[model samples]
Every structure is written in C-alpha cells, then in structure tokens.
Target: MAARDPGASVPVRAAVARQAVEWLVELQSGEAGDATRAAVQQWRAAHPEHERAWQHIAAVNARWRGAAVPSPLAHAVLLDTPAVPARPLPRRAAAKTVAALLCAGGGAWLAHQATPWREWRADARTGTGQRRTIVLADGSQVSLNSGSAVDVRFSAGERRLRLVSGDILVSTARDRAARPFIVATAEGELRPLGTRFAVRQHAGSSRVDVFEGAVAIRPRDAGQAPPRVLQAGQQARFSAAAVADTRPADGDSVAWADGMLVASGMRLADFLAELGRHRHGRLGCDAAVADLRVSGSYPLADTGRILDTLRATLPVEIHFITRYWVSVRPARR
Candidate 1:
C-alpha cells in the first residue's frame, strides 16, 4: 500500500461506493453475524477501491473520535467499526450517507429511504417523490415506486432485470423472441408466468405480490429446496434461505402506483414511516404515540395535508423541528 496524497481523493465509482456503504449499513445494524463480517472482509479484498472507500469512512470516523465530539449522536454515527454502539444508528443513517455519496461527483441520483445504495448505479431509477413507467426492449412495463431502481439486460436468449432497490410493479409483455422474463434480487430470483406483479426489496428479504398470473420464486441459498409458485391474488415474502407461506395479496400493495397511501388501522408510526419514504430526511414518532392506530386513503402527493389531517383527527402533534426533520408526538396539554 502506498501513502495516498491528502489533496487527491481517489476517484470511486458509484458501484464501489455502494458496496462500501452496504457493508457499513450491515455493520451498524447491530445484527450482523459472523458470516456477514467474513463477507465484508472478502468484499474489501475483492477490489482496491473497496478498501479505499472503507478506509475513508474509518479514517473520517477516527478523526471525529480524536476531536472528542461530546454528542452521543455524533459518536454513534462516527463509530463505523464492528464494535456496536450503545444505540446504533438506524439503517436510514447508512441511506443518508449513500445519498450523499450519490451526489458527490458521480452525477448520480439520491434516493428515498428504504433504498439500497446500489440504486445509485442502476440503469433506471426513480427518486424521492418520483415514479416512472419503463417499457423494456421486450415491451414489458416496469412501473417504479418512489425510490426504486432496476437494471435491464436483454440478449437473444433471455430478458432479465436486476432489482437494485426499492419496489416496482411489472406488467409483462409477450416477447416475440420467446425469451423468458426474469427478475433477480439480492435475496433470490423471480420468473413471472405471463403476469402482472409487484416486487419489493429490503435488507434481507424480498417480496412479491402477484395480480394477474403466477410467479416462481427461488431463494438465493435454497439450493435444493423447490421454488414456490405464486398464483394470481397471492403473495409471499422470502429470504435467501426459504420462502414464507403464500397468502392472499393485499389490494393496497399497489396503491402507491396510484399515488395513494392506503392504511387500514396501521400504526401511526408505521404510517408516518411509509409517508416519510416520499419525503426527504427524517420523520419520527415518539413512543408515547407510536402505537396509535390509523386508517385512511391519503393522497401520497400531499403528505403535508395528510399530516394536517392527522393533527385534526388524532390526539397527536406534528412537530416540524426543521424542514427536514418531523416528528409525531402526544399533543401537549
């Protein structure tokens, strides 16, 4: 290793930067296992820039530590090591860092919460508060949700999409070339059976809701286990190991495509969390009012109005701490 110049930062591709951030997120999640740590080591060794990006964070965090920053929040965020903090930063913290990286010299697009850093490098993407419908070379339609991304790869033999992050509703178009339409995610693979369906990805799992036809789901690590087939109106959530039992698909799953957030007695915290995905920065709920139930078909385009409606109906106050940070709490007496 050579002593790097302080003035010249290494040019890091968005792809490599994303991998670094992903490792950081898992490390900060406080739930990383031994396998995860080993995987992180292998990833760092896989490329020189991988190590550079990683050391960049570690060095920055080290500088923060040496500065003796007294704030607990600062320490929690700056401690990027395997040593877990008393209160680890949420996954959103990693998301925020990746968002910044996307904006840093890459001409990449920053995404909303719940999106993986890899989305920055995706072939097609939708940003915070944005949705798009993409027609594939095979004529298939992919309707991206807020903060979604996908990469398309088509050849004479196959038509495939790699889901980088977030969620999408796919409407398959018959291919003149007789190519199979497949979608790959970090957790597994999906082969649609002439269908319309929605796919959503999170940290360790993937979910699919089938609307018109059937879909076959094979977990990434389920080497010998049979892939589950989901029929119309069915849904399932699966991880690398196995698939959960299929259930009737919730009609509201696709409501976002219609610019609606349909909540049926959802917790106030959960509702705001979903709504937060459409907005930038932090949206939190104090524990005192977190479990309050909410039901509505609110227009997603008007989250501000939705908050006003909540303020009117529920016994809660909307605190606008800043333009970027909002919280729901028990109304002061």
Candidate 2:
C-alpha cells in the first residue's frame, strides 16, 4: 500500500488516486493483455502509494458485488447534485450505491487530472521557489521559472521546446546544424529569429516577450490570422484564434531569470498573485487592499521577506492561516 502523506496537496493526491482508479478499470475490463498486466505491476511497484490507492479502490468495488444501484443515482453523485432522497436508502443498498458513486466520481476526477499528469511526465520541471536552467544539446540555454515544466525535442529539422506549463526565458545559441528554433504553447508557436526571449503560458493564451532580435507568433489555427513579428522590447499575447496587439515589454517580464520580481506600480493583488506562483500553497489579497499599488525589485527566493516588506510599506496587514496559507487585508488603524 502507498503510504499516505498528510501534507500532500489535494491535486497531488487526486492525481495519484485517479491513476490508481484508471489502472483498476483497465485491468477489470478484461481487455488488458499480459503486457498491460505486467506494466501495472511495475507501476504499483514504482510507488507504494499507488498500491495503497488501488487496494482502497478495490475494497470499494468489493462492497457492490451483490447489490444493484441505479445508474442515475451514481451519475448524480458524480455531478455533485444537491437533490436528496425523501427516504434513506437501505444499508446494503446504500453500500452498493456508494461504491457506484466512487467509480463514477473517480472517472470524472481522471479527466480533470490529465494536465497535471502531463506536467509530472515533463522532461524538465522546477518546483516552487526553485528555478532551473538546462543547456540543450545544441548549446542553447532554457531557464524554467518556479512551478514550470517544459519538454525539449531536438530533431534534425528543428529544435522545439514545448511549454507544458509556466514560463521560460530562452537564450538562443547559434546552431551549427542551422535548425530553426521554436517554442510551442497550446495557443500557438513562436519562431525566434536569432533572439533572446521569454514565453509564458496562461490559462487560455500564451505570452511572448522579446528581449533581443525578433520572434514570429503564429496562431495554432491557420485561418485565424497571419503570423506577426515582435521585435526587441515588445510583448504580445495570443490565443488559438488571434494575436493581441504588441505592447512595450518590461524588465519584469524576464526578471525571474535573475531570481527577482521587478514590479513597477503593479497592483497589490497582482503582485501577490505573481509572488504566490513562486511560493507554495495559497497567498491572496483581500478586496480591500487588492487595488493598492506596489513597486520594487523583490527577490523571488524569499517570499516571506517580500510579504513582510509589503506589510511595512503599504496599508495592508498579512494574515497567516497556516505557513502554507496567507492573505493580505487592509491594515488596522
């Protein structure tokens, strides 16, 4: 059985649990061949927690062996329906219903866990409060910011870096092979024309900031628009359908590569949100102080000290719910 850690985040636990449930479902479906079974054994052995989650899920399945539960009831539970039964279900029947609920809920959870699983399998990643630089085989350097993941693929024709999640600062090195360098996000692909630049992946869009030379932003959908070129000191955001207008880039866009967050008149809420990206757990600002402005070059390595500085200089107070959870509110007069 996998040893459970009390400190693991909900997302991490859910991801593991989902993987376990997926393995169980595949094996039980009677289609998993000998190789599939062997792979499952290897996976379970790879992590004790995987075995533990599987055992627990198996126990849940065992409870429904002899009882029948309505599919609608199971589906309702998976959807988090608020409707309640007028009369309580019988004990044996209730156990069967609960087991069905667990199976359906697990399937839904797996769908939500897909992205995190990809990040887990990323070729390169950085943890919270940590930054990493990987020198590619071609001598180009890619720096990953905290909580970032990227997959590097260098083929004979082109050098591609997939921004799986988070942000990266790329310094292009002249390739002796003369392969074109490109960075891809869900929204589009960025082709650097001998440039130093940064690419950040947001929820539904990707941002490109060019520090030197130029980059061509091409939307993933070919008919959306033509590729737009951004020169040095320019930044732009693009979605699958369209590219936004170019704006003047700022030092803060690439400052994380230097282990600092350079904010000039940034909103308190925005600052805290960016800081939270580098720190573990949750850090938020109350609406009362969210609009306040902040400016400075704060070290990303010391989030606590940065928060302390904010409290000292601004009209805001920091509240610690736990070491992992914090909020900033209007300072008490």
Judging by lDDT against the true structure, name the best candidate: 1
Every model's TM-score: 0.69, 0.69
Query: For residue 63, what is the lDDT in candidate 1?
Result: 41
- The CA-based lDDT of model 1 is what? 0.75
Q: Rate the local accuracy (lDDT) of all candidates.
A: 0.75, 0.72
Worst 10 residues of 1 by lDDT: 105-114
Native-structure RMSD, model 2: 14.2
Question: Model 2, which residues run further than 4 Å from truth?
Answer: 1-108
lDDT of 1 by residue, 108-167 (tens): 122222244557557898767788898887778999998789999998898999998889
lDDT value for model 2: 0.72
Against the true structure, candidate 2 reaches a TM-score of 0.69
Report the C-alpha lDDT of model 2 over 103-203, residue by residue, as the tens digit. Answer: 44354333444554456558898766789899999889999998788999999999999998889999999999899998999998999999999999987
